[model samples]
Target: MFNDMMHILTTQSGDILTALREHILLSLMAIVIATVIALPLAIALMNHRRAGEWVLQVAGVIQTIPSLAILGALIPLVGIGTVPAVIALVLYAIMPIFQNAYAGLTGIDPILLEAADAFGLSKRFKLFRVQLPLALPMIMSGLRIAMVMIIGTATLAALIGGGGLGTFIMLGIQTNNNAELLIGAILSAALALAFSWGIRLLSKLSVRRIGVLLVSAVVIIGGFAGYRAINQPAGTITIAGKLGGEPEILINMYKDLIQADNPKMDVQLKPNFGGTTFIFKALQGGQVDVYPEFTGTVLQSLVKVKGSISHDKQTAYKQAKTLIKQQHNLDLLEPMKYENTYGLAVRQADAKRYHLQTTSDLLRQSAQMTAGFDPDFYKLSDGYPGLKKAYGLNFKNIVQMESSLRYEALANKQIDVTDAYTTDPQLKQDHLVTLADDKHFFPPYQGAPLVNDKTLQKYPGIAKSLNKLSGKITNQDMIEMNYQVTVQHKKAAQVARTYLVKRGLIQ
Candidate 1:
């Protein structure tokens, strides 16, 4: 693990530093924006107690929505990237700052104000010279809270391509690289602490102190803008992928193929895009040009196809392609040979002991056992609910968790049954057996490239470049490549390069 950390630091030092700077800029901007709005609003509402309470209540309600949900919701209105991410952070930061500012101003002793008035001070003079100084500590406390919240929440900006430490964390989860995850998490906590400490230093504010802070903020903003202006690159094609080794490898494969054939085309990969839905959203929103997707996912989730299994596999794939093109203006390229559908898995011991060979067999024992599934499975039509109704399955307990953690949870015997991808490498390593879907509950999930029509029109060679791998990868081939990463701890790029070279797809 130590060696892994060193390797990452050495190879990705520039990326790490860039992400840290972006994180700081994003969080600080949100807190500063929120403070600017909240401080003035709090001051105006100081005498209007009833109105203050109402405003705070409304801000509180906005804060109740999950941060990711708020960010996702803002995509359509403001579009993706830093603007929406900063907006979400600012919304979350408002409540704490506003509430604290109101409390501090209202709680000030009336005698102090009376004394200021007796001294023949103007209203502005009293606010700046007397009231604000006394309320400085409480206002700073609010600022501290807002700053800390912004720093933590800003990590999610990477999901919308805002770019931050969260990029490393998401990629780490997708690739199962502990060093990357730890680096992102540790840096985020450190940033929060540093920001909190900086805010704490302003417990007693003076005119000069405020002036110095304002100047510093201006300098930082100017520097950030200059950096952004100088860093813009051209001819970049953005590629995104869902969470998992397969997607990671596929995205890397696309990058290599595109650049190898068309040297002028530069590929920028955005892997571990949280989920299939988010990836699709990014493509449709023009945040990403292309990504790997499963035909079954497009048909079932996006097209909302019912009774998908009734149609032949080719028919389902063709219908999905046509509908996606007509509705979303997205094209589904020729699919690979492999089909990675969901499967119910159990430990080899449990399978042998219960003589479970099919979904029906597993159902017979489900009443006495617990099952764990990925969160997406809960929403799928042919997933848990459909299976339960089909076979009358009622597990003793049902746990919904991340797909990556399911295999480990099953191995530890924490769950008697869990959802597994047909091509998951851990299945072979842990000697887990997949129950046959005798009832044919799932649709075919052949792998393919889902590209935006605009991207194809802009770069006509993209489709031709991507279709080289069509019908190339078989089920066993995908399983072996996944094993090379998850079990052997090989890098996804290395695995992808080796396969493409061996198959003579790339030089």
Candidate 2:
């Protein structure tokens, strides 16, 4: 395991370092921007105490909004990538900076203030020369707090295509790769420590420390700017994916095919996006051109199809494709040869103890056990609701949590039963027994490429290129590839490329 970890770290050194750099730079930028905006506001509010307090209250409200919620809200307005992420960081940071700045300015020695006034010094002159200097330490403390928050919160930025160590963290969860998760967590913690140290060093108010901080900031920012300037590629088609191993492989498969066919095709993979709703919004808004989606997801969630859906994969795909084209101006291509529908699963021990062979069997024991499910499953008509109705299940509890964490929760016996995708590598790896839906509640979830109509019109080759992936991957092929990524800890891109090569789809 140590050797394997070392190999992963070495091979991913470039990505790790780049992620670290981006994390630090983003935190620094948010802190600096917050300080710049809040310092003056704090100084002004110091004179008008009541109004200042009210303004601080507003900043406090902004801080109370969950970072991810803030990110989601910003998507429609600011779009995805770095800008929205940075804006969220800044919003989270404002309260601390404002509070400390106000406190620092107001806490100045009265005698010092009286002396400055008696000297007939202008208010602005006094603030700049005396009060501001004295309050620097307190302001620096607030900046430190803000920096810490930004560093932690910035991890969520990856959800919106904003790159950072969070990229690995998100990918790790998606693929069930513990090493990648550890790397992301360890490096993020390290970055927080390093940033806190730098902030502390600068708080001493030494000229050399300040100079060092300034120079470091400049180099980091300038380096990123230069990198971006030099690496801007033309004619790139942005393909997005929800955060998961399947999406990771699918998107990479698209990139692999595109690049192999035309090295200059510039297929950009935007992984770690939020959920179906967010991705759908992004596609409709033109933030992304193409993405991998499930036919059932399109039919039920996007198209809002009423009643029990088609069980036949081909029929479902055709219906979903037609509805999506008419409604969302999107095209659903021919599906891959796999179905990744959701199903209820429990530990092997539970299965044996309850003699569970189907949803009906589990339903009999449901009253005594606590069930865990993803939030989406809880809400989806074809998910818990439909299953509960079909099997007449009534559990002791139904805890909603992150889908990625569901397997761990189940393995640890934190949840007696949880919903899982049929293609999830963890299901087999963890030895969980899936309960058959004898009542036939869930619809077929055939995987396919969902492309924007505008993109297809512009780059006809994209449809042609992506369609080549149609009917390629089988159910067993998907399971193995998912295992290779989630259990074997191989990179998704490498796994996709290997599959293509094995199938003679690419050289």
Candidate 3:
């Protein structure tokens, strides 16, 4: 596990750094913008006295909108990426800063203001000398709280292609990989803690020398902006895709390959890992260039085909190619050997007790069993809802869970059965029994790269290199690679390189 952590740290160090930096910048920008707007509004509201309750109520209403929902709503008007994420976070951080600033300014003794007025001090002079100076500590406290909240909320930015620590967690959940999830969670928490401590220290120092501290803050903020401008490259490439499973892994694999081949390319991989429908819309709207997709997913989810096609690999590939080209103006590249098919996984002991050797056997006893599935299954047409109808198997209960939690759920006897991918290494490692699908309702899930037609025309080499990787990686290979990251603790890039060398794709 230590080795795996180190591997991930080394390989994804760039992405981790980028995520942390972007998150910090976004949070700080939000708080700063909120402060600029809120402080004056707060002062005005407090002075009017009659408007105090209304202002507080208005700020309270803004706070009530859920962060994720606000971000999602902003995507359409502002579109996906960093801008919307920043705007959403700024709006979310406003109330805390506004409320505290208002209370701090109002709570001051009226005698101080009267003295300033008696001394013939202008309104601006009184605000700068008396109101702001006295309220600095309380305002700083609010800023601190707002900063912390923004840091935590920034993790969700990955959903809209903002690219942060949330990508790892989302991918981990999709592929039922725990190591990535833990790493993502830990790194985010550590970053937040570090920022919190730094802010607290600043708050303390501010009390002693306010002038110096304010100048230092401005310099620090300016320094960060300069660093980002220097680091940011000229060109950009946006990659988008649906949430869950092996798709993200494949995208990262391709990204590494591209960068290794041509280091000068400023390839920015933007992951739009959300619901399948969400990603599909992004692709159609030209929000992304390439994403890993399965033939079966396109057939069942996109095309909305009811029944199944032949398991013949060539047949499936041809159908997928035709469908993508005709319907979406997209290209389905060479298919990989790995097939992430849905299957019923049961604990070894349970399977043995029930003599469940196949789906038919499991179906016979389905009424007495309970099952767990990834949350998406509840929504997808070809998911559990469709599977039950097609097979006529009814479980005693159905539990919606994150994919990573499904194995534990089954082992702990929380559920008797689980919907799992055929290539999951845990099925072999944990000695879980997988029942064969005899009904053939599930289509061929051969992995392939889907690209916008324009990208293929522009980067012809990309297609060539990716095709070279096709059929080279099998189901066993995928399981082992996934295990390396999730169980054995190896970095995804290292595993990919090792596999490529072993397969003679790269030297």
- What is the per-residue lDDT of model 2 for residues 1-507, given as tens digits with 9 covering 90 to 100? 567567769877887898887787788778876766887799888989899989989998888888877887888887787778888998989899889989999999999999999999998789878887888888888988888889989998888888899988887776656678888888888888888898887777653456466668667766876788599686668999888777989999998887777887777888777678777777887778888999988987899675667877777888899889988889998788888888888999889988998888886789999999999899977678878887789999989998778899999999999998888888778888878777767888889999889888988877777778888887668878888876766788999999989988889
For candidate 2, the clash count comes to 0
Clashing pairs in 1: none
Model 3 Cα shift for residue 81 (angstroms): 5.3
Q: What TM-score would candidate 2 get against the native?
A: 0.84
lDDT of 1 by residue, 255-293 (tens): 888888898777888765666666677788877899998
- Once fitted onto the true fold, the runs of candidate 1 whose alpha carbons sit more than 4 angstroms away are 1-21, 44-51, 122-124, 165-187, 226-231, 306-311, 346-381, 384-406, 409-418, 433-440, 484-490
RMSD to true structure for each model, in Å = 4.2, 4.2, 4.6
Candidate 3 yields a Cα-based lDDT of: 0.75
Distance from true location, Cα of 43 in model 3, Å = 3.9
Worst 10 residues of 2 by lDDT: 206-215
| TM value for model 3 | 0.78
Off by over 4 Å in 3: 1-25, 44-58, 73-82, 161-223, 226-231, 235-245, 256-266, 270-287, 299-329, 347-357, 361-389, 392-403, 409-416
Of the candidates numbered 1 and 3, which has the greater TM-score value? Answer: 1
Q: What is the model-wide C-alpha lDDT for candidate 1?
A: 0.84
